[model samples]
Target: MTPRYSLSQIVLHWAVAVLVPIQYWTGGSIERTHHAVHMGLSPDPWDVIQHQIHNYAGIAIGALMVARLTLRIFDRGVLRISARGPVDRLAQAMHFAFYAAVIAQAAMGFVASYFWFGIGSFHVLGSRVILGLLALHIAAAAWHTFVWRDETVDRMIIPRRTSS
Candidate 1:
């Protein structure tokens, strides 16, 4: 049997998974408002609410990412997955890409808040690229479960029995 991810690993994974989509939605809401105002259209009054939510969620995600990084570094039980095989290499690459994209997006949002100097938005581009990678990641996981007959995704999922 494959060793399962630690409890902290599972929690952090799900936490970020939930927060990222919410981050994207809130960022889109703000971007839309920005565009509408730029185009001389009246902005929706509720946009202010969305912007506030985005701001708070961004800060929270940033903090959680920091914690996630720390935990990842210290974690010794992360799935080894057949040492240096092609799929393992691809998974490693995607993991690194995710970390970079997520950190860049969060940092850009933070800096943009204080330094709005007519700079173009990277949120849309960043989100699209990251989302594409995420889709690939999901497809790979499905392949492992269905085609490869490996319990890869199961490592990340919480087990029903603690002492199994």
Candidate 2:
């Protein structure tokens, strides 16, 4: 039988999925707030709220990544492919890269917020890298769903209980 992710894992995965986009959407607001602060002027009320959302959501994402990684390391029920192949290896690599990228981005955002060292451009570049990774990840899922006819998407979308 194919191993499937546990219900708790599925929930965490989706939670991060939801928050990632929120971070992207609020990315611009952070810049605006940063600009105002550096300019020695009060930030616009709406920009401040958006900036807060970005900060909190980013922190949440970082925390969630920690939880997700901890579960991944300790959980015995995570999906495991029985057969090893090139595609399988690629998929595994992509997942690892994504996990690392997200965690780093979150930490970077926090540190940058407090002590930005004119690295705003670097942050923007990192965000773009994340976007590219996300797009590839989604593409991979779609490929698994359609081309491979694998249940990869289904696994994350609808988890099933395993018998003890």
Question: Who wins the TM-score comparison?
Answer: 2
Clash list (residue pairs), candidate 1: none
Q: Estimate each model's TM-score.
A: 0.82, 0.91
lDDT, candidate 1, 44-75, per-residue tens: 87886787787777777777777767766765
- Evaluate all candidate structures by whole-model CA lDDT and list the values in order: 0.74, 0.84
Q: Where does the lowest 10-residue lDDT sum fall in candidate 2?
A: 74-83
Model 2: per-residue Cα lDDT over 47-159, one tens digit each: 99988899899999999988888878787776654448898888888887888988888888888877874666777788888999999999998888899897788878777
Assess candidate 2 and give its lDDT. Answer: 0.84
On lDDT, the candidate that comes out on top is: 2
Candidate 1 lowest-lDDT run of ten:
74-83
Clashing pairs in 2: none
